[model samples]
Each structure stands twice: as C-alpha cells, then as structure tokens.
Target: MNLALTVLNITAPVFLLAAVGFAWVKLGFEYRVEFVTRMAMTLSVPCLIFVALMRIEAEPEALAALSLAALSAYGIVMIACFALVKVMRLDVQTFLAPLIFGNTGNLGLPLALFAFGEVGLGYAVVVFAVMAMLSFTIGIWIVAGRGSLKRVIQEPLVAATLLGGVFLWQGWQTPEFLTNTIDLIGQMAIPLMLITLGVAVARLETKAMALAGFLSLIKVVICVGAAWLAATFFGLEPVAAAVLIVQVATPVAVTSYLLAEKYGADAQPVAGLVVASTLLSVIALPLILAFVI
Candidate 1:
C-alpha cells in the first residue's frame, strides 16, 4: 500500500503536467510546439544534461557501468525490434525506428528525476544521451535509408553530452555564478518537456489503433526484458538498473511520427503508435516503477 502511494507520488506530477498541456490544447489555447521544442533542445535540456553530468554524485565506476548497460540494452532492443517488424510484415522504414527508440528524453528524464532524484537524473541523462546518438544515427538511417552524420553533429544536445562527460571525468566544476545560471536554465527542462509531450500527443491523429496497441504491448515487454537482462549482465547498481529499465521501456516518442512524415513513410500509422504507446505508458511506467522501487 505504501509502495503504491510512493509510485503515485513519483508519477503523478509527470502525467499531471502533461495533462495540463493536453487540457490547454483541448481548451483551444495556443502552444507553438516548434518554438518550445527548439528552445528546450537548444538551451534548457542541454543545460540540464551538462549540469547533471558535471555534478552527478554517483561514483565514476557506477556511472560507467550504467552507460555500457544502456548501450547494450539499446543494441539488443534494436535487433529484437528488427526481427519483430520483419515477422509482422510491417513497413520496415515506418515501423522499425519507432519500435526501437522509446520516449527516453521527455518522459524518461522526468520519471528518473522524480523516482530517484538527482542521481537518477544523472544516470538517466547517460541513457538519454546514448539514445540520442543512436536515434540520430541508426534510427534515422532505418527510416530515411541514409542518416546524416553532419545532422547529428549539429545537435547542440550532443555537444552538451560530450562536454558534460569530459567535465564529469575531470572532476570539473563551473564557476558558482555560471553554474547557478545554467541550473536555472536546466530547471525549465522537465516541465517544458512534459507539457510539450502532452501538447504533441493532443495534436496527433492516429490510425490503425488495433495494430498500434498490439505493437505497443510488444514493445514494453521487449524493452523491459532486454534492459533487465543487460543490467543484470553488466551488474548495474539498483538505481542504475531501475533507471535503465524505465528509460528504455518508455513508449514510442512523438518524434517517431515526425520522422515518418519527413521521410515519406506513412505518418498516420506512426501517429497511432505514438498515441497508443503513450496512453499505455500511463499504466505501464508506474507498474514497472513499483517493481523496480
């Protein structure tokens, strides 16, 4: 009973903030997703990642273990998702990327923060960074048949991740004033991301929900299984293991829909995936948290 409430305490704010965005959109309020996303990605989120990585309280060895565990989990998930897509006779370009990459950024970051606090966020950032690199490189390649290394290099968040890792490795700290300013900027990341997630979902229009639902369930199972196996194999600490599972098992990101649209794949089905998987997450994340916690 206490555990249930604990899970609720952790997840409520996440969904509630998202709900605010959902309701705001439904009430005919104006929200410019493009501008908000650009600001968050370029400014707020990178700041958050840099600060989190720089100031993470976890041991270097533990952090390193989680990083490798996350990478292995994602690699295994890619293979599993590939086989599943082929077996289902799905459009590989449209379906494979969505299945492989989950919503590790907007959803995973906040959940890790709430469930396990700053240290969890630190671990989560590592996983998020891994996902970002893979998504831009291999994920884009899967959907577009030719990913651009130049495009990935242009992402500000990627630079932030690399710099942050360097800082963490060297036991470096920014000046107090600079750190405070960056911390202030970083503070916007979670709320903005959650709200943007809701807004994005509200705007998506789905098709083939039945297929979406089935695939969504399959994704959760595969992600949890793979992450758990990887964490155990790599002997990640408890918090690191939990964070990896949650991050990897997050639902299909709304970005998947945008990618499909851009690459000339069928966007409607991907939209269905985004919606179905997200709705599934409201229940799925908490249950997983309960077990992990």
Candidate 2:
C-alpha cells in the first residue's frame, strides 16, 4: 500500500500538469509551442542543467560514472533500435531516432526530482545532458541525413553542460546572488517542458496507432534492458542507476515529430510515436518507478 502510494505521489503531479496543458488546448486556448520550446531550450533548460550540475552534492567521480553509463546505454539502445527498424522494414529516417531517443526532459526530469529528490535530479540532469547532445547531433543526422557539429556547438544547453562540468570538476561555486538568479530561471524549465509536452501531444495528428504502439512497447523493453546492463556494468550507485533506467526508458519525445516535420521525413508516423509512447508512459513509468524506487 505504501509503495503504491509512493509511486502515485511521485507520478500524479507530472501527469496532472500535463493534463492541464492538454485540457487548455482541448478548450481552444492559445499556447505557442514553438516559442515555449525555444525559450525552454535556449534559456531555462540550460540554466537548469548548469545550476543542477554546479550545485550537485555528488562527487565528480560518481557523476562521471553515470555519464559514461548513460553514453553506453544510449549506444546500446541505438544499436538495438536500428536493428529493430531494419528487421521491421521501417523507414530509417522516421523510426530510428524516435525509437532511440526518449523524452528524458519532459517526463524523466520531474519523475526523478519527485521520486529521489535533489540527488536524483542531479543524476537525471546528467542523463538528460548526454541525451540532448546526442539528439542534437546524431539524432539530427539520422533524421536529416547529415549531422552538423557546428549546430551542436551552438546549442546553449551543450555550452551549459560543458561549463557546468568545469565548475563541478574544480569545485567552484558561482556568487550567491548570481546563483539565485540562475536557479530562478532554471525553476521554469520543468513546468514549461511538461506543459509543452502536453500541448504538443494535443496538437499532433497520427494515424499509425498499431505500429506505433507495438514499437513503443518494444522501445521500453529494449531501453530498460540496455540501461540495466549499462548501470550494472558501470557499477552506478542505487539512485544513479535508478535515474538512468527511468530516463532511458522514457517515452518518445514530442521533438521527434517536430524534427520529422522540419526535415520532411514522414512526420505523421513520428507523431504517432510521440502520442502512442507518451500515452503508454502514463501506465509504464509509474510501474517502472515502483520497481526502481
């Protein structure tokens, strides 16, 4: 009973906030998704990553282990997803990226924060940062047929992650006033991302429900397995291991559909993925949390 309540307590706020956005859109409210996404990506999320890394209480070595574990897990997932796509004869451009990359930002971050507190948030940010770097570079390459290192370098989140690493490595702290200001900005990231996720799902149109649902199930299974392997191999501490598993097993990111639309690679299928996987997460994530937590 306590365990069930704990899982519910951790998960309910996340879905509730997303529900608010979903309801807002269903009621015909105007929520500019592009603007919110840009602000969150360019400003608030970067601040959140920087502050979390800068203020994290975990030792630098432990964070490093988690980083390597995250990278390994992503690599394993990519291979597994690619093989699945090839075997199923799905479009490499549309299916591979969505299957490999999950919604680490919108869903994973808040769950980690609620389930494991600040320390979990710290570990979650590490995985999110790793995933972001790959999504901007390799993920874009998969969808667009070309990768741009310059674009990756120009992303504010990447810069923040790098800078934050430096601060963490040197045991440096920003001035108190500056820290508070940045933390305030960082605070906007989670809600903005969650609401934006809901808004995007509401706006997306998808017809490939059966395929998307099957692939989403496969994705969760593969990702959970990969993350578990990586965490065990890297010897991640309990919280870090749990965070990695949850983050890696998160549902398809809404950005996958946006990327498909922008790159002209069958957006509808990707949209189906986003919607299907997200809806599945409503049930999947809480169960995963129950096991991990």
Candidate 3:
C-alpha cells in the first residue's frame, strides 16, 4: 500500500501538468508550441542542466560511470531498433528514431526528482544529456539522411552540458547571486516541458493505432532491457540504475513526430506512435517505478 502510494505521489504531478496542457488545448486556447519549445530548449532547459550538473553531490566517478552506461545503452537500443524496423519493413526514416529515443527530458527528469530527489535528478540529467547529444546528431541523420555537426555545435544544451562538466570537474561554484538567478530560471523547465508535451499530444492526429501500440510495447521492453544490461555491466549504484532504467524506458518523444513532419516522412504514423506510447506510459511508467523503487 505504501509503495503504491509512493509511486502515485511521484507520478501524479507529471501527468496532471500534462493534463492541464491537454485540457488547455482542448478548450480552444492558443499555445504557441514552437515558441515555448524554443524558449525551453534555448533558455530554461540549459539553465536546468547547468545548475543540476554544477551542484550535483555525487562522486565524479559515479557520474562518469552513469555517462558511459547511458552511451552504451543508447548505442544498443539504436542497433536493436534498426534491426526491428528492418524486420517489420517499416520506413527507417520515420520509425527508427522514434523507437530508439524516448522522452527523457519532458517526463524522465521530473519523475526522477520526485521519486529520488535531487541526486536522482542529477543522474537523470546525465542520461538526458547523452540522449540529447545523440538525438541531435544521429537522430537527425536518420530522419534527414545527413547529420550536421555544425548544428550540434551550435546547440545551447550542448554548451550547457560541456560547461557543467567543467564546473563539476574543477569543483567550481558560480557566484551565489548568479547561481540563484540561474536556478530560478531552471525552475521553469519542468512544468513548461510537461505542459508542452500535453499540448503536443492534444494537437497530434494519430493513425494506425494498433501498429503504434505494438511498437510502443516493443520500445519499452527493448529500452528497459538495454538499460538494465548496461547498468549492471557498469556497476551503477542503486539510485543511478533505477534512474537510467526509468529514463531509457520512457515513451516516444513528441519531437519524433515533429521531425517526421518537418522531413516529410509519414508524420501521421509517427504521431500515432507518439500518442500511443505516451498513453501507454500512464500505466507503464508507474509500474516500472514500482519495480525499480
């Protein structure tokens, strides 16, 4: 009973905020997704990452282990998803990236924060950063048939990650006033991302629900398995292992649908995957949390 309540407590705020966005859109309100996304990505999220990394309390070795574990897990997931797409004869450009990359930022970070507190958020940020780096580089390549290192270099998230690492490594602290200001901005990231996720789902049009559900199931299984293997192999501490599993097993990101639309790669089906996977996570994430916690 206590565990069930714990899981619910951790998960409720995430879905509730998302529901607020969903309801906002359904009631015919104007929410400019592109502008919100740009601000979150370029400003708020970078602040969050930098602050989290700069102030993380874990040992540097632990963070390093988690980083390598995340990279290994993602690499394994990418290869497995590629094979699955080929076997199903799906369009690689449309399906592969969605299957491989989960919604680590919008959903994973908050869950970690609620479930395991600040240290969990720190661990979650490491995984999210790894995913973001790959998504911007290889994920773009899969969708557009060419990757741009220049674009990756220009991303604010990338800059924040690199700067955060330097701070962590050097045991440096920003001036108190500056840190407080950045932390205040960072506070906007989670609610904004969760609401944006709901807004995106509300606006999406799903097609081929059956196929999307099946693919979503497969994605959760693959991600969970890959993350588990990597975590075990890397000897991650309990909280770090749990965070990695939860982050990797999160549902298909709404960004996948947007990328498909932008690149003209069957956006409707990708939208279906996004919606199906997200809905599935309503049940799936809580259950996974119960087990992991």
State which candidate has the highest lDDT: 3
lDDT for 155 in candidate 2 is 91
The estimated TM-scores of all candidates read 0.98, 0.98, 0.99
Error of 3 at 278 (Å): 0.2
Worst 10 residues of 2 by lDDT: 145-154
Candidate 2 on 1-293: residue-level lDDT in tens? 99999999999999999998999999999999989999999999999989988988998889999999999999999999999999999899989999999999999999999999988998999999899889988999999999878888899988999998899889999999999999999999999999988888999889979999999999999999999999999999999999999999999998898899899999999999999999999999999999888
lDDT of 1 by residue, 1-293 (tens): 99999999999999999999999999999999999999999999999999999999888888888889989999999999999998999999999999999999899999999999989999999999989989999998998999878978999889999999899989999999999999999999999999999999999988899999999999999999999999999999899999999999999999999999998988999999999999999999999999999
- Residue-pair clashes per candidate: 0, 0, 0
Model 3 superposed RMSD (Cα): 0.8
Evaluate model 3: give its lDDT. 0.95
After aligning candidate 1 to the native by TM-score, how far in Å is the CA of 83 from where it should be? 1.1
Residue 253 error, candidate 2, Å: 0.6
Across 72-134, the per-residue lDDT of candidate 3 in tens digits comes to 999999999999999999999999999999999999999999999988998999999999989
Q: At residue 10, what lDDT does model 2 achieve?
A: 96
